[model samples]
Target chain A: MKKFINAVDNVLGESLDGFAAAHADLVTLGAERKFVRRRELNRSKVALISGGGSGHEPLHAGFVGHGMLDAACPGQVFTSPTPDQIVEAAQAVAGDAGVLFIVKNYAGDRMNFEMAAEIAEGRTATIVTDDDVAVEKSTYSIGRRGVAGTLIVEKIVGAAAEKGADLATCVALGERVNARTRSMGVALTSCTVPAAGTPTFALGEDEMEMGVGIHGEPGRRRVKLAQADAIASEMTTAIADDLAAPAGSEALLLVNGFGGTPTIELYLMYNAARRMLEQRGLRIARSLVGSYVTSLDMAGCSLTVSLLDAETTALWDAPVRTAALKW
Target chain B: MKKFINAVDNVLGESLDGFAAAHADLVTLGAERKFVRRRELNRSKVALISGGGSGHEPLHAGFVGHGMLDAACPGQVFTSPTPDQIVEAAQAVAGDAGVLFIVKNYAGDRMNFEMAAEIAEGRTATIVTDDDVAVEKSTYSIGRRGVAGTLIVEKIVGAAAEKGADLATCVALGERVNARTRSMGVALTSCTVPAAGTPTFALGEDEMEMGVGIHGEPGRRRVKLAQADAIASEMTTAIADDLAAPAGSEALLLVNGFGGTPTIELYLMYNAARRMLEQRGLRIARSLVGSYVTSLDMAGCSLTVSLLDAETTALWDAPVRTAALKW
Candidate 1:
């Protein structure tokens, strides 16, 4: 496949420089090569920091701001950010309230962030977000893979910090959001990283993989392209079955575009999902329909549901200010 | 090129269903197709409603929530949502404080929103957001097109409203944010709308276009691909020259990936831009780098700068809660 890039090697470095130049107001690069918090630290509040691969734009970096993360480490394209970078980010942004590290449940991310957290354990409080419901057997593996649900946890935990909630409060809230949230994704095609300059994996035009990882890895199952409504049903149903939440329970639905799917198509899939849920007597109390978390330029989406209580809803409704998402 | 769609006609409706099912906690669609506000409307608070085309995902619908818009109408891909949809959205969301319409500066959007605004003129306070820096003239023939700047205005104004700033305050703040913002875009390759099933425009391997719009329309000028640094220089120079805010002035820089450009490349461009600005002695106080607003699978990105002041910054920092964005 053809790609638009100057050189494969220079793609990542050049891109970071360009991003910093354009967004001088909200972010600054630390000496260790990561975007640090631009907002003034309240000192009384605990700072939240998270980062991983670079392909997930708003995830690691775009989320840096007031009511969210204080800093993000952007690793090379699809790779994990280094421990050194995470260490610098923690030191640069930490305050008296301390810093919370919200690392995703990936092996590389876990290893790196945990190492950094261990190194900075004396300086900041650390927490892991294993919100992905896709994996359940932590007995044999590291843990559940953190996915888009991490954003929900970050926002809730960040808001707790902004509201003068202690580190313990923030950590508890983070775990609560993570516990309530579940996500599963599918990919229609594997996208080529600019530096890689080739498709991550090959798939037929008519075939799509369900339960796909965001980093262009193979999914649990490959299936034929079905009707939009049918595919959405499959994805949402899988999530519902995993949670085993009753049909009548109130829930928050998130239909996230992996990257390349158009908003129009996402909305179409959203409409189908609503019908399927209504048929099952489920009450949708809230919904988020967009590409909040993306998989490079892959052409597919994921479905996430968070069973809600009054407290989680209130936390979700708390205001947050960030680079990628602002209200 | 190959795609995974099962059919074209059912794309929108089905996606909407899937989205509602997935995000059932953050929003819900009224039977009439209105994306209703998830939070309980404070009886005395004014409601904000916005909508236009379907492809701009988080815009109209995703903005609906506590501090942003109360309702959104989703159009077919690249096409304006029908007048009836807008009217319904206005009626469903409007309350004692009235409703404000934040319409982008597109011809079809203006016409449809204008007509819908007329329908609710007597019942609600209608405010139109004509914040596109590209559209300098009020007259249709030479007017600037609205782009990423509209999203900023929406967020700021929405926050002001949520803080109990009256309808007039929201309107005034929205206008101020728009006045302070300017945006320009470039495309390396044309986007492919799923229904069209091919690229909207054919670009050569070494070609790029400047001053491109979001819909994959031909840009003001086509040129050869330059170094990433050179591309950043040209794009920023044009935007800076147009705004003429002077060096050393603090501004909020937004480097938005249209659709396909990865975050790494965006950050590289941002770093280049920062050096360019710093060398010119400009101060960037805050920056937003992501793909918040986008075209349909477009292979390009846009840069937006909103010169900041205490008032704008305060408004920017005000808390907000929405489906797509928070804080």
Candidate 2:
């Protein structure tokens, strides 16, 4: 595979080092590169920690800052971080208010974060996210795998935590946000893993994998390639149907790229997805279109819809500062 | 080619529609989709206008908003916009302080913008950028091909314009910034133009084009793929040599992806570029890394270095609120 990496074994370390250096004003790397944490921590505010495999960048690590994650433990690509990494991160960032772990619904990640919480100090809680409606079970997940909607959960809950909410309040907010959000993805091409030096899976040029997972896992089905409008229709229908929000409910639409998609196509997808949601009588009160949660260099995009209440909408508008996101 | 597009001809229109929808608070589209202008124009400030081919997104259009371009016209993919489009844009956004056009140094773009400036009303000035050090002349350019450094020119000069710089002052500052900046790119894979339905150019599995242009034009030479550090070294040396800033000079290093490269690789490149800059005795006082200027979905990146003085540094730090960039 053609990639801008020095060595397969050193990809994560070098990239993390570059990330920490480039965003030094916003985040700091944990000892031994186990995690990334906010440069300045508020002692009275509850700390929000989230992490998963490393490929989905700008997710856990890029979200660490004033109005997002306090600490993010990054595992190797598509692999779970060890419990020790999570424990050390919690020990480094946990404050008087307490600590909350935002874990994706993957078996390895769930187990590691659970073990870390059990061994770490302070009042800790876990909010597991399973917002992907793509499938009920996947290669590494028992239920729906957490996908791009995880960004929404982290963003809204992170705002609440930034406002000095208690650990219980943060946990409740996170779970509520996750429940209101749904996501589905379509992959035009499989991503190459550095270590593997090959695409995760083979996809014919004229075909696409619908409802694909973030790890390039098998989705609902592989179908002949369709136009952007059709793909948007299928993905949006899956999300809106699963959300089951009342007609005229306000929502936030996110068109996320799987690393390799360009901004123009993402915006085009957003237009198609927005039209589909409007047809369902959902008001697109807010919208985000870009590659925030990516799956390496996979050529695809994901559509996420989160039913928004007044509180959630207000939180989503709150100020934030971090690498990959700032306002 | 696999792309998220409904029809080749509608890509620009649909994407612009979505962009206007997503950033309604910041920008508005002109009639007939001719240009994208700031939603709230400041009549007291000199208006900054820029336009070029559509494929290099977020360059001209995404930079339109507060503290940046007042209006931007997008042409067809890899093709220059018509003079009528540029004239109409200037007419729509020109304020009492007049308009200053920021044109990339391409044959078509320069010719079109020049014609627009002649036909456009009110006091107007133009600043042309030719920062690429790859080739003295290329397929579409007479001098060096303007590349990623155009963004730095827009940003620094835009900040000055927002601060109420006169039309003449804005032009002079833009020219100065453009003079101080230099860039070089490398492409690992070719991007497919929708209308063409094929890659712009082909490279063997083990080959790469160094000092490539944003449009996948032939570069300095084709060479065997090298490690990230070696590639960074070659690109950084070419830029640093052309820039020729005094030792200990303050500089802004920008690592821009050519659409398809992931954030991990971009940041890693940033690190490599940073080290090279330091080795040359330049202090990296400011850094911007991301896919701001892209070549559709080409898998590669460019390195841009701009010498920064006190005035330019302060201006670069000024607030900007746009779709692709916000602070």
Candidate 3:
């Protein structure tokens, strides 16, 4: 592999070490758990906890700061964190207002987080996000897989929690955001699992994978790679059709990179995606165009549209301080 | 050739269109020129102007919100912006206190920015960043090429300008930041210029390019790619040697990805980089790890270290809302 890493076994450990050491001011690592919480917790607002596999940088970890997540538990790359990690994180970040868990809709993630919420010694609720409309089913998922729309869930719910909303209110807000959002992704190249030391899948140079999952899971099907505008149209059109928002509806668009894609391509994709959304009558409202969510070293892009009203848009625009997805 | 683009000639224009459309709330695009300015411009404060080629997505444009750049002029992909674009942008963004131009040390960028400053109807000063220490000279550059350290100059000076620092003060601050920083980069694979429709250079699957320039220019040498620790040591050692700061000196570390590298790799690189700097007795006071300065879709990274004093660190931490870098 051409990746810059030490032992494959130590990839997640050392990366977390670096994350803790590098962002010491904004967060503090749990003493004996793979969890991170804000450095300054006031214990007045509802605590927000989110976690998943480790490959998606800046998600659960990078989003832990003021006006965002209260705690995050990171597992091995593409592997779900254990229930123990989630419980410890929830306990650590719990405030007087109780806690809310934001779990992506994956078998491993949903099971582990649900178990944690049941066993945690505090009031807790869960909002599972399954916004990826890539497939009706998957090898390891019951429903559509959660993808980039998790960012919208985090931002909106985190803002609500930060504003001293109660745990029930935060949970409702997260569910609403997740339900209103939809995403579809495409991959130009499959990412290598550092441990496997090879690509998860293969494709010819001129071919591409549409409706790809974040973990290099099989996409809708392989197709001859087309132009940037075409790819953007495919992803955005899928998301728009799934969203099925009325012509006069508005949306918060996120053009996410699958780790290895360039910003130029992301912008190109964003241009086409925006046009598609506008032409379809979804007024392009607030948008975030960057790699907030990524598969490991995968070359591709994803389009996510969160149909929005003033409430969701205000929460998104609310000031957030995080290592990732900031404004 | 694998990039998602329309006609090669439309890369820059359409990408800017996506940027403006994507971030219409944060910035306003020129009606007829390639410039982006803050949507809510304040006329009393000094305005910060910086721009160059368009491929570096988040650089001058992404940083064009409240506490960062006031305006950015985008050239065609990998090509310098013409003097006319710069003159119009400089004149438009200039405030009562005047305007400050931040230019990279590339020959074309310098000449065009200098020409624009001369003709713009405002009091202005320029700070050219030349912190890349990969080689004594480069093909399109004299001395050293400006690389990731330009972010430090822009962040520090932009904060100062937003705080009402005079033109002279902002220039002096920017110069100091530029002087105190050093960077070195490497590429595992060459990037393709959308217009060129081919990789800028070729590398074997096992070979790597060390100390490469941002535009995929040759570095000091190419060698078999090493482990992450070894590569980090190489880059940090080179920058630390160039800085030669006294023992226990503080540093602000910026680990920038050249677009294609994964955030996991960037974090791993950051971990190794922090260890190396700490071993050499340089306390890493502030750190930023992301793809802020990119070279299209190149697969590699650059390490920038700016020896920090209390003043510079304070400026770095000041609250600024930019589409790119925000605390």
Q: Which candidate number would show the highest lDDT if scored against the true structure? A: 2
**lDDT of each residue in B1-327, candidate 1, tens digit only:** 434344776655655555555555667776745455554566467777777776666566666777677777878777777778877776666767777778777789888887876776444554444434433465667377778887788777777787777777777777777777778788887887778878888989878887787777888888887777777787777677767877678887777777666565566667767667656666777676666677867767777878888877777767666656664
Clashing pairs in 3: none
Give the DockQ ranking, best first. 2, 3, 1
TM-score of each: 0.77, 0.98, 0.96
Runs in model 2 deviating more than 4 A are A137-141, B137-141
Candidate 3 TM-score over all chains jointly = 0.96
Docking class of 3: medium
DockQ of the candidate models in sequence: 0.37, 0.81, 0.72
- Model 1: how large is the Cα RMSD against the reference? 5.3
lDDT of each candidate versus the true structure: 0.72, 0.90, 0.86
Name the runs in model 3 displaced over 4 angstroms: A137-141, B137-141
How many clashes (backbone N, Cα, C below 3 Å) per candidate? 75, 0, 0
Q: What TM-scores does chain A show, candidate by candidate in order?
A: 0.92, 0.98, 0.97
Q: What share of the true interface contacts does each candidate keep?
A: 0.62, 0.64, 0.70
